[model samples]
Target: MTTTVLQNIRPWGAESVDLSIEDGLVTGLAPHRPGSAVPGGTEVLDGGGLLALPGLINSHAHVDKSWWGKPWVSYGGEATTQGRIAHERTERSALGIPSTDSTELVMKEFLRHGTTATRTHVDVDLGVGLDGIASVRAAAERLGGALEVEIVAFPQDGVMRRPGVLELLDRAAQEGATSIGGLDPAGIDRDPVAQLDGLVQIAVDRGVELDIHLHDGNDLGIFQIELLIERTVQAELQGRVNVSHGFALGDVQGARQEELVAALGEAGISWTSVAPPGRGRLPWASMREHGVRLGLGTDGIRDLWSPYGDGDMLRIALGFARVHGLRHDAELAAAVQLTTTDSAPFVHRDQHELAPGSRADVVLLEAENVQDALLRTPRRELVLAGGRVVVEGGELTL
Candidate 1:
C-alpha cells in the first residue's frame, strides 16, 4: 500500500493537478495546491509544473534483434525486405542478436526515450527457435516491470518456405506469447493462402492473436489484406488480428480504397506502422472514420536491417504526422495520442492515461502543450512506471 504524490503537473497540458498513486495504480487527482502538505510516510515528487503524459506505448518493435548499444553496424543489406531478412539470418549469430544483455540495452534505450510499454516482435525461426523469446522475457524481467513488453513470436524468415516454422510458432503461442507474427506471405512465401491459413489456424487453435507483416504493395498487398479480413472474420478473431506495414491500403485509390477500409473496420482488424519515408501515405483519415485502429512503432532500431532509430516514440509520432501531412494543432495532438492513450490496445491495456485507475506510468516534459511536445520532442524530465521512478532528468535510474 505504498503511496506517492506527484505535485504540480499538467496532464496533457491541461490545468495543473496533483496526481496520487498507490500500489502502482493512479488513485486520485485534484487541482494543484501550491505549498500543499502531505501525509506522513508518503513519498512525494515535485513535478516542477511540467507537462505530463502517459508513458508512450510502442505498438510495433523488434526488441530481440536490435544491436543498440554496440559499435555501429553499417547497413550492408539491400534495401528490400527479403534482402534484409537474408542479411539478418547471416549476421545475427555473430552479433548475439538474442542475448539478454543486448535486449536489456535496447529496453533501456526505450525507457530513456519515455516508452514504458511495447509490443515487440521477437524473431522465431528455424534457426533461433524460441531463444529470442526467452531472451526478451529475461530482459523484461530484469527491468523489474519498469517496461511492459508484449511478445509476438515473429517468423522473420518465411513460415511455409521453411519447414517446421509453423510448429515453432504454435509452440510459442502455447508457451504464452500474446501473439504470433507472420512476414510478407505473398512477397516472401509466394503462397499467400497457405501462409495466412497456417497463421490463422495457429491463432484460432492456440487462442492467441495474429499479427502479420504485409510489405507487398498495390494489388498484391491488397489481395493479401483481403485474405486477412476474410480469415479474421471466419476465425472469429476480430480485434485479435493486426496488419503491419500494409502498404497496399495506401496504393489503391478512390472507391476501391473506401471499400477496403470499410471491410477492415467491419472485420475489427487494426494496423501498426513505423511510418517509414517514401512509402505511400496510409489512408489514415478513412481508417479513423471506419473505426480502424492505428498504432505507431519504432520497428527495429540499429538492427541488421537498418542502422537507424534511437527507440524514440516521440520522433516516430512526429514522422507519422509529417508523412500524413497533419498540420492542425488537433491533428498534431492526435499524433502524440497515437503513441500513448490511443495505443492502449496494442499493449493490451484497457486504459493508459494520466487518470485515476490507470497504471501509474507518467512522463513529464518541459513543454507548453501536447502539440508543443510533439513538435520539439523535448527530453523527458521524469518518468514514473508503476509508481517507480525508472528515469529522472533524461537518464535511466534502473
Candidate 2:
C-alpha cells in the first residue's frame, strides 16, 4: 500500500494539521509536528503552511458546448431562451466543434482549478443524438484517475415539444448516462404533468437520477415545482431528484418562500444555483436551514446564453457570497462550502469528507486560513484524489 503525508497544512484554514494517507484514504489527521521524521517509502507533500480544503464540486454544468480556449462569438439572436438555443445550435454546428477536443479542454480546465468532480448536463436530441454523452464519457475515461464526470442526458429543447426526445433520453441513459435531465415544462413543454411523468419514468426505469432545468418565473415556475414535488412523492424519488435554476423562488414573498423551502427539504429534492444576478437569487440560506441540498455551479461557459462563465467555481462562489451580502467570516466560509462540502454529495453520491478514513480528494491553497482562501482565492499548490497527486505547483500532471 502507498502512503503519503500532507504536512504543515491547515484544514478549512484552521489549526495546522498533518494528514497521512494510506491506500487513497486519510489514515490520520493531527496537529503538525515540527521536524517530523520521514518514514521510508512514504511520499511527503509539503503544504508550506497552506490552507487545505475539500476539492470543489461543480454540480451543474454543460461541458459539451463550452467555447473556452476558442474564438469569441457574440450573441445576435432574439433575447428569448428558445431563440438563444437556436442560435447556439446553429453556431456550434457551423463551427463543427468536435466533442473529443472541446470536452477535454473544458474538463481539463476544471481539473486545473481544483474541481475533482462535476455533473455535466449533455444535450440529447434528434439533432445532437448522443454525441455529447459519448464525448464526455471519452474525456472521463481518458482522465480515469484525475476527475469524476457525471453526464445528465439533457433535452435542451422541450422533452415533449421535440417529438421523440423522451425515447432519445432513454437511449442516452442506457448508453451510460448517470442521470435524466428535463427542460422547462411549463415554459417550453407547455405541459408539466407529461414532462415530469416522462422524466421520472425514465429515471426510475434506468435506476438513474433527475436534474431538471426550471426557468419559468413566478406562478408558472412554482406550479412546475409543485408538479415535481407531487410526482417525486408519488414516485418516491425524493433524494434522487434536483431542480436547477428555480428562478420563481426569487419572486415569491417571505411566507411563500418559506413554504416552498420547507416542501423541497421534506421532499429531499436538491437545488443547484449558478448564482445569476437579479431574478436568479434563491433562498439559499433558508433552504440550507431547512436541510435542502444546495450546490453551486457555473451554468454555461461562454455559451450562447451569455459570454460569461470560465468553469471557475471558486470565483463563482465568491460572487455568490458578495451578491448575497455574506460578509461575516462564518458566512463567507459557508459560501466556500457551497463549492466543496455542501456540493460534493450532490455531484457524486459517495461522500467526499476531509477527515480520517475519507477519500483524500483535497486542494491545498496558498492562504493563511479558510476565509483567506476565499477572500484571496489563492492558487492551489497541490491537488490530490485518492492519495494520488493529479496537480502540482498549480499545473495538471495527469
* Candidate that would win on TM-score: 1
| lDDT of candidate 1 over 43-121, digit per residue (tens) | 9999999999999999999999888778788889787988888899999988988889989999998998899999999
lDDT (0 to 1) per candidate = 0.94, 0.84
Q: Write down the lDDT that model 2 would get.
A: 0.84
What TM-score fits each model? 0.99, 0.96
- Those runs of model 1 whose alpha carbons end farther than 4 Å from true positions after fitting are none
Q: Once model 2 is optimally superposed onto the true structure by TM-score, how far is the C-alpha of residue 225 displaced, in angstroms? A: 0.6
Pairs with backbone N, CA or C atoms under 3 Å apart (clashes), candidate 2: 13-370
Backbone clashes (count) for model 1: 0
Candidate 2 local lDDT, 184-256, one digit each (tens):
8888988888999999999889999999998889899998998998899999998999999888888897899
